[model samples]
Target: MELKSHSPFIKWTVRLLKKALYIITPILVVSILVTVSYLKQTSEVISKSQNEAIWFVLQLTKEYSEFIYQLQSYQLGTSDYNDMLIQYEILWSRFNTIVNNSLVEHLHQFEGSITEIDHHFTYIKAMEEQLLQLPRTKNESSLLLLFKNDYDDLQIYLNHKFRLSSDDLGNKINAVSTLEIIFRYLLISTILTGMIIAYLLLRESRYHHRLAMFDSLTGIRNRLWLNKKLDKLAKNNQAFNFYLIDLDGFKKINDTQGHHTGDIFLRHVASRLRQLEQPHCFSARMGGDEFAVIELIQLNTSGATPSLLPGKLVSLLNSSTMISGKSLTISASIGISQFPTFAKSIPEVLKQADFAMYEVKQQGKNGAAYFKPYSVSTMKNNPLSSVS
Candidate 1:
């Protein structure tokens, strides 16, 4: 029987690992989704900030141009100089906000931009003070007329500056959008890749677990599985018959015909044993030329013969097999031991059956025996009469 390879610590460690994978898979997916949502929100905030900066600078330039128009009209006696000074003061405040505000400083930080804006504000302040002190005269009108051409040229330059600022805003927004798309794609791909890897690992673990429970050569329950079955039955207080079988003269055939023929013979024997399939009947290949069968029976029967099943199995093994265009014949010596009758437990039952099979092999090579507390009658001798 195969003992469990994992210690208690190892088993718990493996179980914890499986549970951690289950827990982390969902967390990983949720984290990716949250990251995508966060990035999207960040991109929108950045775009909003850029739009605000562009709108502030353009609106400030437009108001400053209007103030220049008011100043020029005051020289023609069509506008009050006080009104022109108010507009100039408002433009100065707006320009100060755009240039000094931290939020849009990056957009306005051109070479000598602060010095140039300060020069404009200072010239406007000096003109406002001088106009307040002068009498209304034609000499003053000529002085203002000379500055009209400079105001027109400045208007043209501000319009071009607003257009360039708008274009830069668009490019920044586009770059932000592209980065968001790439980040979202990368997060989704990482989630998908993790899911695939976890699924494959789970499938491989299940496959190996299944392989460990069955015989690789004969495609039947192995000794470990049979032992586990008997243990379960014993736990349930169920009574069953344990048949231990050893193939007779199988070694002679294997020695002369090679292991290929030996494998064929073992498969044929396993197939024949499986033919005894019925409710509560199971067969197993217990390594090499040894095999076993388990059959559930009544707890306490009157005058029941334990050797009846072994006799049937012996007859089954005596049948002829054809492999590789050559006929082969083999016989088996089977021993019967009843659970809770000859032995009280699973391991004891198997040991008793093993002893009985050895007794049969001792008496003759092709017969069956029942393990008993006292000696019993000898089974009829049916040796391997032919092996062709």
Candidate 2:
């Protein structure tokens, strides 16, 4: 059977899959970087944690060699064995604690040797308890008493225990080497992943540079982006106005119909605005429910300040009904200012337009207000208040 025809849906699916792969590749790289870092960190933690145990082992063996002479002296000359016994008990307790903590803290694949060390510590502890109790049976008068035999047996038993522990650790050295190897491989994998992601992100950024203004969410050019585009026809110092479009009662849509529906509504609103304006009319999302537009063709006249263009906005965004199965209508209060007319500077012009916008909000919800000079009160009466 020959499958000769190509399916459009299949081709589309393949394209989407490739796009997804491009996106996921960067994430994988980043994840590998983090993983490798954690592996290195874990290895360092294990290495540092073993130090206390190793040092204890060294001290314990040295004391064992000196222990017989100290015990014999204490028994013969009325010297107390209490200090020597106390030191030994404390060292043994500390050794057990360190081994137990390592077993619990390092449970990953790298901690197998640490776990085995804890297993041997059980015998070490039993040997320790037997040694501490030996002090009670000491006698000064008998040089060849029953206590001497017991003491010799105790010392021999302890030395043998220490030697056995040392051999067990010799076997675990191979384990440490193995863990170190694994960590190195993990670290290398992470670096490769990071490089691949960095490359993909660069490609994505290159594609985005063509867009004059980007949506805060989807990263697409907006009306404001269109207006502020440096490539406009302003070759001879032509002036242009900045017009900001806003959706009135956008909060109502978000509040009544829920945010997911509101997001879809906003995207639709943006798409519609994109379609109405020409390529010369660059636009962008100014903020939530707010948009901007700039002219493609340059002119000598100033196009600054509230570019509401009279009732031009009212005609543009006045139609809407039923978003997300709910009846709805959208409107906006426009504010406009003239270039080099309402205010001398861009900052002043924007300030005047913003002041006019507040006036529209105060007057009513749906109307345009142009920049007009008005006095703002710097001082209000101090009403009688007991709290102050």
Give the top-scoring candidate (lDDT). Answer: 1
lDDT of 2 by residue, 123-157 (tens): 44555554555566544334223334544544464
- How well does model 1 score by local distance difference test? 0.71
Could you tell me the lDDT of residue 129 within candidate 1?
54
TM-score of each: 0.60, 0.38
lDDT of 1 at 382: 42
Worst-scoring 10-residue span by lDDT in model 1: 379-388
- Give the per-residue lDDT of model 1 (tens digit) for 13-108: 656766776776677677767767776776666556555645775676677668767767776779887787788778878767766667665455
Error of 2 at 159 (Å): 92
